[model samples]
Target: MAGETDPLATEQPPLSAGDLPAELPGELIAPEVAALEVPPELVAQSLGEYVRAWGARIRGGDPGVLPVILGLAIIAVLFQIVSPGNVFLSAGNLVNLFQQSAVFMVLGMAEIFVLLLGEIDLSTGYVAGLAGVIGVQLVQPVTTNFPWWVAIMAALLACAVIGAAQGTLVARLRLPSFVVTLGGNLIFNGVMLWALLFGPFSGYPTLGDQTNPHVLYQLMWGTIDPLIGWIILTALVVVVGGSFWLRDSRRRRSGLVAPPVSLTALKIVLIAVVGAAVVAICNINRAHFGTIEGVPWVILIVIGLLGLWTVLLQRTRFGRYIYAIGGNPEASRRAGINLVRVRTLAFVLCSMTAGLAGLLYVANQGGASNNFPGGQYVLYAVAAAVIGGTSLFGGRGRVLHGVLGGLVIGGINNGLYLLGLDVKVQFVVTGFVLLAAVTIDALSRRGASVGSVAHI
Candidate 1:
């Protein structure tokens, strides 16, 4: 009995980057290798070699952003052709599309925390609702009158505590994340309803009419001045583009593997072009009465958060450990990584991020009502992250993936509305799109595993 071996363990195939290695789907290998060391063959010393390397990755079944780009283009074009008056491509609609997408993007990012560690968060939707109501109630004129910033911080803090509770159950008690978070989802939803309905409030927790949190309302609806838009774009190009250039160039100079100079320049150029395009679009004056224009503040907020989280996940030691744990928990434990602390912290961050999304939802919807669709929102959050290419199995994702996926989800929704499809139809189409993405993910993994065994 003491020497008993697990039959399941013997049949476990092999460890993978985040899942069973079975030779790893090409896309999955990137995270595992990136956390350790870049493969020599994968490193390119010149522009041509870089191009070849990228091609090789695709051939190996890692399509990278290629699928996202192509799928987005197809959606846009199809919608443009089918929508009445071609309004789907109209500048006004496009800007609104971005506004519509803001919440999904943020929620997707929140899910990324535990998702990267091969965990799931079914409770994020109501968690967001609870956080939003707290922020709103804190700023109520009749009672607290807390400053907008203070209210926001309080909301995020609550999210962290919620995350801690759920994470503890999973990380310390070794409970299944799905069950823990599912329970959390129901519990938080009930708490949110209690706060909204039973709690002492002058009215429904509203960011709409409250004079105290006017700035909070403005966050989702307000636009930057046109001149400020250009200035912001310039700053973004210089700051973001410059950082990418400097980091990679420095790596190359130090004899570490990095992209070619030309490639780095290309990336900067693309950034400048895209930023300029967005600003140009936003500046196109879409108002029916008073000349309205400039980028929505939420756009910049998303970009800022993207940069922040990207740095947190890509450049920090904690980020590396998260990836390591996601890829191989036993190995991470063997390597002395504190699985409990890291896992719990990841859940905390996820909730905090989800809280921000909830706050934004308050801004967008004008209030955090008791009827908030936490269930639907959670599904979309998962749909967006997975559609954007974050593996459901984990250890292979980024904040950018969430952003990209948000756009796709946003685009599909925007297009359907333009086509005059019913809300139910929108849901159906979205489900299909999500299904397709998951199917592709599963197939890619299967293909990789078979190939791996053949080689062995």
Candidate 2:
């Protein structure tokens, strides 16, 4: 054992080596060597290394978000070419597209929590519908008349209770998640229908029937002034982005592993570019009757949630537990993770997020009705998550994947509408795309499995 050389030490790398010190003549001769031997935190210590590492990953069955982005781009271009008058890319239409995308994006994100743990949630649609129903009902003038914030909290709390109940069934009783959530779907749907059809006010509760629409209306319809939007973007780019760079630089100086300086700068640049582009698009006058300029409040809500979820998943122990449990439940249990608590929390968070999506749906639709299309929404939520590059098998995804995937779904829907295509076409396209994504995921999993076996 003392004289034997590591097989890793002798194997060929995918590319020329990184700068990691070598133990032999060509030990670090491959860009992928670091990925194999170096610690995770330092995998991207250089821009070239990041590129090489990601390239290797893609080849090795993990494409990350690249496929989703490419799909979104291709869909955008295709729709732009076919849409009458090229209206798919029009400022007004794009703004409306983003608004329409909010629900799907949020719902996809909601599903990600459970999906990461190799689980599915069928009740999300009705949970969201119930949230909207409860929220709108609570704010009715002749009924509860609760403040908007209180109504929101109440709605989220209710969804959380439902999530906990279903999660308990799966986690504690060892019931199948599909059966548990399917039951929840029916239960919540019935409750929503009853509340809508037989409740105190009416079957349809609106935000502004003699009462103020309040923040509920504002969340979807309100806008940040163009100047203010620019200022906020600038502040975020300079302050938050600068803080990250400083922290990473300090880490490097202290002999700690940190992302390469160039990689960090490139990320900041990307943020600035995307933020600026969003503001520019939103600032364009998109109104037919009057100038409706400035970024929509819904955009901020979506972006804010994206940032929050990204941090929660990437930087927190809870996030790690989710992935660990999802990737290998047996190993995770052996590693001392409280499997029940984490899974329960995942479901709770998923439901609460769906509640938020419900409120947004109400905002966009102007009312909560019995015909919220919860079933269709469930399908779309799963489709968007899958299309966005979140693996169906679990332990591989980001919240941004949901957003980008939502964009693809929204884009295709909007583009088809512009082209006067039937609604069925949209569903057909989405279904085919979802199938392709699932196929890719399955193949990637197999590829990864093969690679692991070869190494072993």
Candidate 3:
């Protein structure tokens, strides 16, 4: 019997792994398996679900700029109540606040470009001064007698070139950004001093005479007509609202988890209210000539710049690369991004924006000065960016954050000035605010890391 082949075991082809079937025996299937069902309400389908998701996101380490906005509102109300006759809430003071925020708004944005790459640019302040001086000299009879706009462009070009060189050192040499930018700050400041002190100037500390064109000066002091402001505001509201709605709808149609239509509408309505308020306030007859002023050019410039930068950072491949690099440099490199180019471009862009800020500063002051405290200005820029909820660790910020932060800073300064607070008190208050912002950033990051670990 052992040597004989049984009828059931008759010789045949061998069963290969591929010949194995997946069908289980009839007894193996569980009866409960057929009863399993997913509930519809458990899935995110309504505005409430969307809000819950946002709350979860916040709890998971993204507090966003909501705190800053709330802080701004709180500060405004506090100042309004404490200040005599609610002077801080006056239209004149509010107008001044917008004008005051322009420099930092630009500088804060400039810092963001580098900050997104987890880098810092300490030289932005001095770079701004140098660029501003160059602009003044070129447009004046004391130098090349170039057009004001040409002078501005040339100055920005110079800043870009300077940034590129420094970036080369940072990207190619792999030097520490803090050290490199520190040296740059000193060098640029020295250059600014030399130019103002000896370079074709009639006197120390300033470039160009009264005979110089007032175009640059007008930047900080000019306002558009009411009609133009209304038109621009309308266009912006309609276009921005439509675009946001369309984007959400498209995402939803494509089966993505887009925000609820109600949320989108709320955002649109809020924007419209704010826009209308600004326009209406500006259109009030405040001038001695009794003419209707629409909006300050500086405000328009800041908004335009904010929009442009938001597009760049949120919608571009270069921006994506910047974030990727900041998140993980090695991963970004392995993904075939040209790390050196992106880093270098970031530095150049930072300096160029600083250069624009410099122009605005000079415009605000009515002339370029060697005595500009660029170091202090840079600190303010950093503070603004941080306070607006941009993470110091990089890769987690938006240009809008910078704008909001700048506004916060401007509001504080304006409110303090109106309250007749001492300069020392202002400094102490600002320091505290900055410290709080940094603390928030640190805590949020730690929380997020912990949350991720728990998930894992």
Candidate 4:
């Protein structure tokens, strides 16, 4: 009686859906504040899901570098099919492509650091020439007889100073980058010409002899032994695969969503396959007398730099800040980002990279000429970055983009020459490609913005 009496008096009746409390004592709690979200594609739990998510992301605006890669493949096949000599895919021509792309790729990377910050450096081309001239002068026996490494540092330092000075004007004085770098372009070009004429050992139009600074230029042209190349490729595969696994595992352990294991494994396998193909291609005996050649040193340099820059941009805070600033400068400033410091550093990095590129240019050509066409080189660098899928409006790009774009440019140039086309046709084709890339970027960004608004 006592137990049943409370049913109509004080005992609680069974709760209905309408009578349920706002929250249940035993129910799972929904978060009041959501944590920062990552792209579902980046954290997919399966290969199929990853692909689906990636496709969705592409639809939303991040097309990545796949389009450029596909375009490059198509170009290669098309050129081979159309060329009478079938020289597009020839081993010698392929080697030449690697050599030719190195300077453009390096310069593109230089531009990328600034471009990501929504800035430009018109002076990089002449800056490179000036640095190369200084480096050559420092290493010449008649001038200083300094070691090549020392000359390299001094050259880079000079370029860094120039970049830092220009950066100061842009960042501190609030001057337009276009204006500052345009002035720098003119000044650096004049300085380059003067250095070529009066710097240390200069009598002929070219500073160095036929050897030109003693085997420095040969660095890009030299080949690693076939066995050594294979070994390096194997090591790279192992290291790369191991790294992916470790990084994913760490992320998972930290309670972060990570890429599916299968996807990571597939990436590793793909990379290994690509690396193997490159090594095999280079190992082909292309010499007339059946001499064995392997991967060129320039290829190694490019690969190394690509890896380094990719890590910097994807894994570092500085890189993240560059992107944030580019995406929304006002928001970044509000978030306490040191805009001036970051911008200055970006410029300095850009110039230093330009200096490195100049070294590569000299190495590839044996010497830097007074008529290095610095302005044209800068244009080419921009084209390479843009074609490789980087956006000109900033907030979207990567160093690898430049590398891929450089390949496309080099391919176009090489294919045209192989087909016996003149510079005029090449220029027209390249211009069209640049225009197409920009159009694609603009449309993609618009679509992404619309999608985001719709989601909101």
Predicted structure with the largest lDDT when compared to the true one: 2
Ranking by lDDT: 2, 1, 4, 3
Models ranked on TM-score: 2, 1, 4, 3
Q: Give the per-residue lDDT digits (tens) of candidate 1, residues 1-456.
A: 998753212222344457544464565465433322343233766778777766655555566567777889999899999999988878899999999999899999999999989999999999999998988888877678899899999999999999999999999999999999999999999998877863465337677565667888988998999999999889889998889888987887888778778888888899999999999999998999989899999999999999999999989888888888898888777566778889999999999989999998998987778778899989989988888888888777888888888899999989988877888988998899899888877776676556545444
Q: Compose the digit string of candidate 2's lDDT tens values, residues 1-456.
A: 788653212223333246333555454445455464343347875788777777777777777787888898898889888888888888899899999999999999999999999999999999999999888888887777888888889999999998899999888898989999998889999999888874555688788844445678788999999999999999989986998899898998899889888878888999999999989999999988988999999998998999899899978888988988898887677556778888998999999999999999998888799889899998888888999989888888888878888888998888888888999999999899899888888988888777655554
Task: Estimate the TM-score of every prediction.
Answer: 0.90, 0.90, 0.86, 0.89
User: Highest TM-score among the candidates is held by which one?
Assistant: 2
How well is each residue in 129-234 modelled by candidate 3, as lDDT tens digits? 9988887777776557778889889999999999999999999999999999999999999998877764545534243344444777767777999999999999
RMSD of each: 6.8, 7.9, 12.5, 11.8
Give each model's whole-structure lDDT. Answer: 0.84, 0.85, 0.81, 0.81
Q: What is the lDDT of residue 180 in candidate 2?
A: 92
Supply the TM-score for candidate 1. 0.90
Runs with alpha carbons beyond 4 Å of true place in candidate 2: 1-41, 198-201, 209-212
lDDT of 4 by residue, 328-440 (tens): 87766756677887889889988998898888887777676776879988888888899998888888898999998888988998888888899899889989989989998
lDDT of 4 at 60: 68
> For model 1, what is the alpha-carbon lDDT of residue 312?
93
Candidate 1: list runs displaced more than 4 Å: 1-42, 198-203, 208-211
Ten residues in sequence with the least summed lDDT for candidate 2: 7-16
Residue pairs in steric clash, candidate 1?
15-21, 16-21
